[model samples]
Target: MDRPWGVPSPIRPGFAQAETAVPLMNIANILTMLRIALVPLFVVALFVGDGHETGWRICAAALFGLAAITDRFDGQLARKYGLVTDFGKLADPIADKALIGSAVIGLSVLGDLAWWITLVICGREIGVTLLRLAVVRRGVIPAGRGGKLKTLVQSLAIAVLLLPLSGGFAAAGMVSMYVAVALTVLTGLDYVGQAARVWFAGGPGRARGA
Candidate 1:
């Protein structure tokens, strides 16, 4: 018979668990943290003091572009050098969200993009991240190719929107953003559907201590 996940007993008062062994101060992990750090700079350059200066727009786009590069490089380094750690696995996605989420929200707040579009994109991202964490201990659901493609589209769209461009060029960026939003919603549903299948097949309980 399969074991049941029965109700839990009460925890002892003041009990503390052992610390997980998450390595620190590695180059790959540094790059991941750098991406997170860049989000604030990107926001500031894009929105601070009315964001009208051409120089500021250029700075914002440059910061975002650098952050995106680090995102790609960090993962590649981790995989190539066997530097992957629990902390990297957790922090990396959070960093990506901070970068992309901040970009979309900033654009909307600046009246460059529509609020409804931002709502859909950010909602999907935050919801999926939480869902992934909830079921991660059950089994790892690696990023699919479609998910990577969505990231690429989002990066390009955000960069285009950040640039100080003519009205026509800016409108083109909005078109790209809409395409990204479509992919974001589609891939998010795909992920949830896959997780549901895994749960139905008894995959979650198998990795209780993983």
Candidate 2:
């Protein structure tokens, strides 16, 4: 059927289902499952020791780093192996956010990070995710360039902060913290701006229109 622009609509129900039906059991999905599994282990580590103890904090950070690394590895593997199913596309980022956001909030509660900062970061992450859900159709936002850069920076920042390395590493973590904050703000704004464009284009508000 012709869309408003007289071009055929890009979405077809069967296309996405077909994409999902292919052999999807792959390394990328495995890594995503691994990341999901790490969440509870991370929480357990955080609570196992006194909140002030550096050891537990370091372990939480390390688990966060590994999950972040898996984020990259899974995406690359999916792309390399043609394993990019709709499920993978949807679940990979959500898994990443759940793991990272949890870590950030946990660390903040443990006094590793400032509460407001964690709130801001996590809030933006959730808001942008909802925005994406609102406008996933109409081909407006395809996990565009800015979003990818933001994730990369956020991952690096989180990894550095989680490291048990002392002295110089501590200084590095401080820098990473601020860097992460800045990137989070920029990326959040970028997502909103894009969503606004899509909203105005009848894409974002399509559900309501329907």
Candidate 3:
């Protein structure tokens, strides 16, 4: 099919599945699964001691950083060498949500992050995840730049907050989280709009019209 409105079709990544669907145990998918596996380790370290205790917090941050780094590596490897599989497509985002969602919820439990911030961010994450699944057969709703930026901001916020910092650094982390929240909401709306066009307006066929 032709490109979608001069942008590559959101489902373009799915094409990787067609070409490299089998041999699913490639490096990229392994990295993604490793990321998923690290979530519990992160949680254990996070809650092993009182919330702001230095040692546990550092362990948690290191585990979180490792997991986050795996996320990038998996995606890069997937794209860099035709390694995307259906499992990777499904597991990658689930891994991300498991990691970040657990962190946010753990922070709320530890009284670091506000319950409402947790609610808003987690709610959007869940809802958009469901939205992606709902529309998957229609077309891919690939992550836009804004969505990636939001993830980066959220990850930075979580990392900083996990570091047991104080004063201005803590303040900056809070600000980063709020910015992430705003971008999350905005991108959620953007996804809805993009989905409407892709699935409802005969997305693939209309590429020529544009």
Candidate 4:
């Protein structure tokens, strides 16, 4: 029989209780959804007025920044409130990739950023995502500090590049982008290593035995 929320299923004495179910809709999930919804609007703002009008560029950056802020809070809210759900797990990363990918790609298309940079970052993101899925059955790979830092750097770089800035400010944006790309590659390698460890440990089941 299916166990109801807060109802403990059969377990050996001294074992921890089964976790209660979290609702699919919650503040954290709503924030993630909002981030995803902003992507299209951000793209539109990016392309408006030949994609270079200072006003429209600011609008695009604001939209992107808002989306990134949501990314920051949603995870915290989920963990703090014990509101993590399967849907949130799936959608949160998708929303992040969509937002970042769109920003970089749109900037490249608009000639604001280089294509190689976009390709490198996007490739790494896609590769890491695939690695995560490949090892998901073994265990969930929580985001490490390095990964969080990389995301922060990437979002900041994208926001700077999205703005209609030039001179030293533009140079700084490029420099930050280089740093973001470096972190992307480094963290991707780290994730691959973590996945390998999880797979070798025979997943959670065998790890518990060990």
Candidate 5:
């Protein structure tokens, strides 16, 4: 049975069987793959013409925005349509990290953003991703509200920073980025705590209700 979004489910044999009933190539998974595919294209746009050409920057921001939109829809589609499969569980976050990672790294490379900010945000994302993998056998820790808020803020900040803006607009972007970074660190710590609980609980059977 489909549970609420972000709630962990026990990794039982029956859970695997239920997941098998959902095809791998559902709409949600397709959107997720599309988001992943857009990353390289977004990078290309970002780097075109010395990586700061006005038109190219606009194109890159547009591509990033599109990918972010897909990220929003896919999860909702999966839950509403009962299309949540194991592949979706794994690939969705990977797609998110790919898009966000590429954007921030590309921005840093172009000197549009600070390397320290990039390092902190990317570091937290990478660490959380590894934590998830380290405890995959326990259960999937779905993105909580804090995590979702962080992504939303990160995307907004990146979108602003991608534009060739200055003055107050530029300051606004930095402020937003700072908030996103704060959320990133806070949520990362929360996920780590959750993973530790799930880990010491022995398995998903016990972690599910947690």
Candidate 6:
């Protein structure tokens, strides 16, 4: 049953019915959902800023930080409590993309960030997500360290760029944005290379029975 908060009280274990049942209300999934919910609040905060750069940055960073915290917690809880699910595998990344991508778009529209930066980041995200969906039927690829690093940098950059209204914050934002750009480029290459190896290199023969 789903709780008032929308979490299933007792999660069924595994994707297949033959698997044993487990509680779905694990901390990880809860945190993942919470992160998704926070995105709107972050957006409102960003837009509400009356030209206060520092205020905007701090609020945005706090939102991103909260999301980041949940990102880590959910994974840790899933692993520790044996509550990992296919739903989680799909929802986590989608939630992340939605949250971060929206922030990027919002910031870009506000001229706090360049459209090209958001474009590059969103492009990679959309591409990777599609690739994952394409290959999901065959096997699951656990999130790797490089992907994690990319997300971390992206979040930091978004936070830095959203400062409310401060010169020091702007300087910091510039530095962070450059770092994020580098990471974004590197990660895009890494994902493309991985896709090549998986699809072109005949890895697993095209996700199953192909």
TM-score top scorer: 5
lDDT for model 5, on a 0 to 1 scale? Answer: 0.84
lDDT tens readout by residue for model 1, 125-153? 88877876876666555667788788889
State residue 202's C-alpha deviation in candidate 6, in Å.
8.6
Better of 2 and 3 by lDDT: 3
Clashing pairs in 1: none
Which portions of model 5 show Cα errors greater than 4 Å? 1-20, 202-210
Candidate 2 vs 5: which has more TM-score = 5
TM of each candidate vs. truth: 0.82, 0.77, 0.84, 0.85, 0.87, 0.78
Residue lDDT tens for model 4, 95-194: 8988999999999998888999999988977887787667767776777788888999999999998888889998999999999999988988897888
Q: What lDDT tens digits, residue by residue, belong to model 6 across residues 1-210?
A: 232332234435564543434456556677878989998888887777463466665777788788767877677666655667777787888888888898889988887778998899888889878877876765555565677887887777776666554688777877887787787778777766666666654454211000
CA lDDT of every candidate:
0.77, 0.70, 0.77, 0.81, 0.84, 0.71
Show where candidate 2 strays beyond 4 Å.
Answer: 1-21, 199-210
Best by lDDT: 5
The better candidate by lDDT, 5 or 6, is 5
TM-score ranking from best candidate downward = 5, 4, 3, 1, 6, 2
Deviating ranges (above 4 Å) for candidate 4? 1-19, 202-210
> Model 4 — which ten-residue stretch has the worst lDDT?
201-210
lDDT string for model 2 (1-210, tens) is: 322211122447778754444355566777888988998898787767665467886787777778778877777666654566666766777787888788788778767778988988899988877876776664335566666777777777766766556788878877888887887888788778878888778552211100
Residue-level error in angstroms, candidate 2, position 206: 19
TM-score preference between candidates 3 and 4, better one? 4
Q: List the residue pairs that clash in candidate 4.
A: none
Candidates 1 and 6 compared by TM-score, better number: 1
